[model samples]
Target: MELLGLDSFNLVVRHGGFGAASRACGQPKATLSRRVRDLEESLGVRLIERGGRSLRLTDEGAVLHAQTASPVEAINDALNDIRAGLGRPSGRLRISAPILFANTALGVLAAKFIEAYPDVILEISTEDRFVDLAADDLDVVIRANPRPDDTLVGRCFMRNELVLVAPPGLSRPARVEGSAERLTFPAVMRMGTGDDDVWTIIDADDGLPRRYHPKAVLRLSSPLTIRNAVLAGAGAALVPRTVVAEDLASGQLISWGTASGPEIEVWVLHASRRLVSPKVTAFVNFVCDHFNAPTR
Candidate 1:
């Protein structure tokens, strides 16, 4: 049934007559009467007993008034709430992020976001894959080195580089004979990595690039697991500096060298087809501010 007609019928019932309802709401009496008639026709029930002495309700009208009165009021309240909070961030916002980013920064970022936007209910999921935002019903996503997508838009919030790190006791390898400082070391590597996988590191002092091969002693999938292995003296591995900043500072892990020309670009993204919601906008601003990074 038409909500306007139902509301008009309720108004007429609550006020005792069409004229009274019109006077109370400043609507034309003809409009209220016509809407009530439309409501009755739509419901296939005569609601009001017309041509009565004052205003009388048919049996069906009485039941409709009893059943729909409170529900209509509730619907109106919910609509009003949406209107009132339109300028504010108030809703459920589902987000997807890479696993390593979530493990490193998402917890603290989520805490601050919820504190600032108490109205928004935030749900975050951590996975390493680039998810389909619309298909997954996600409001936002965070990724690293996100492939070019014309359908996605957002800001780059963090830029970091990969570095070779090892336990404090593990010494750097000597340069290979008859080579331009090429070396090999027992290294923890990602699963599926080739045995002869080579890494290039920029020399900190000489500002020259050097090639090194990781003799894979341990192969793990998760970056966090690899970092832990390096800390436990399993072997050296190339990892993101931010992920192991504390370990390097406290002398638990030593940096062998910085990975050559690798920039880890972290981005926050959302679907570009629809209008951005207030909650998503608020979150984007919050993350950019935290990292002091510019929007892409």
Candidate 2:
């Protein structure tokens, strides 16, 4: 298989169609189609099925793409390394991030990052779902409380414990720890990992852990939505303090206490590779420095 054809095929898959790939790379649409067709003919296997409304990758196509995407990237990185020689970060940097974080905070961070490194072209795709670094062709992914994965490596940039918050007009519930007649407050909550609806938190005043039952009146999908519900006096919600910090300071929201669960840790990670790209290192260090983390 010709390397040019392989590159064209990957580009088409990456951009979702030949036309889009042409538009993205400023290549002739017919040339890309011919290259991809040549690539399939050379490999003796059909990669993209174009008989539908849009192009969909066949099983073989997916496997080939996943197998080749990183190696091709490594080749590009090698060339970039030789030319740039640890100079200013350059090239397209693709990233995946969580939805709420992207909407709330990422815009500002992207602006600052771009201002600092003008040569690098930043592309961000926001989704709450986990994505593959190689399969998705992404340089980095930002996640909250990600499980241990040997394939990934990075540093936690933000660590804030969950806190229960209510509207400013709501009165604090009477603390009745371990009491049979404990108060169950009306709360806007997401589905808990456990079966029971309860808030185990550290009392801000006493600095001791407390348990409070929460009756979920409305179930929300994301913390951002829960915060909105809490703001509308829908009910109390367990959210990160950083999420509601500004509201608390403005006296628009009141924190009941910090939850006694794992801290809400946000991390920026990339796939573990032999030679880390300068752009990747630059972005990671930029994030670490912004978050006051000395190192990963």
Candidate 3:
């Protein structure tokens, strides 16, 4: 089949309909429809099922789409890279990151990046769930975990540690020597459904590990929310230090300094198969430099 026909078909499938694809590609809807029909006729198979108010791909169409999508994307990326190499980086870069990180330092960093690379369009998605980068057509995904995924090639820019913190001026019982005295304050937990209701911490004096189950006063799924609750004197919570570094610095919250939780590893992941575009490489390097600097 011709490359033009295949490109039109890909656009239609990606945008879900001819009307949307036409608007996106700056082509007439009739022209796009004709291209796809010509492609199907040349292939001798029904690619799409047309009906009232909706479009569905046939079995053959799905197979062809799955086979061609990656190659087409790679070709497009390569062409874009060539054009960008000739001049300044000028293309759309789509990224996905967690909501907490997006709301924190990532936003500032993104703004700085945009200011530095005025020609590139930066699109960011702040969602808690993991997004399939290739399937979703995203260029990069920033995530926090203990290790990078073996499937993707990326860089770990920072190490995030969870800390136990409380609102400033909250009274607490003093630690007794050689005693595992449990604190009686209510706990604010950042937990999802089916998560265990316990926290592990190490004794600062003895360096021994122990698990403490505080009375659950507020349970939330977002670290930012838990930090805000802790700042409001709701209860002590275990949260990533990045989420509350300013609060801890300003004495809005008090760090318990209990190094019991695991450190969260932050990574920027890209697809392993596609060639790393100039825009993607620039972003990865900028973020790494920003976080890895000595002052940070």
Best candidate (score: lDDT): 2
Q: Which ten contiguous residues of candidate 1 have the minimum total lDDT? A: 72-81
Local distance difference test scores for all models: 0.84, 0.85, 0.79
- Which clashing pairs does model 1 show? none
> What is the TM-score of candidate 1?
0.71
**lDDT by residue for model 1 over 1-296, one digit each (tens)?**
57989888888887889999999889999999899898888889899999986889999988887777645644553564478575577767889998888988999999999999888889899898758875455778999999999988999889999988989789788666677765888999999899878899876456667788889999999999999999888999998889899998998988777987759999889878666767778899999999998645
Q: Which prediction has more favorable lDDT, 2 or 3? A: 2
Clashing pairs in 3: none
Scored by TM-score, the top model is: 3
RMSD in Å for model 3: 3.1
Clashes of each: 0, 0, 0
Q: Which candidate model has the greater TM-score, 2 or 3? A: 3
**Candidate 3: which stretches are off by over 4 Å?**
146-148, 174-184, 193-198, 202-211, 293-296
Work out how many backbone clashes candidate 2 has.
Answer: 0
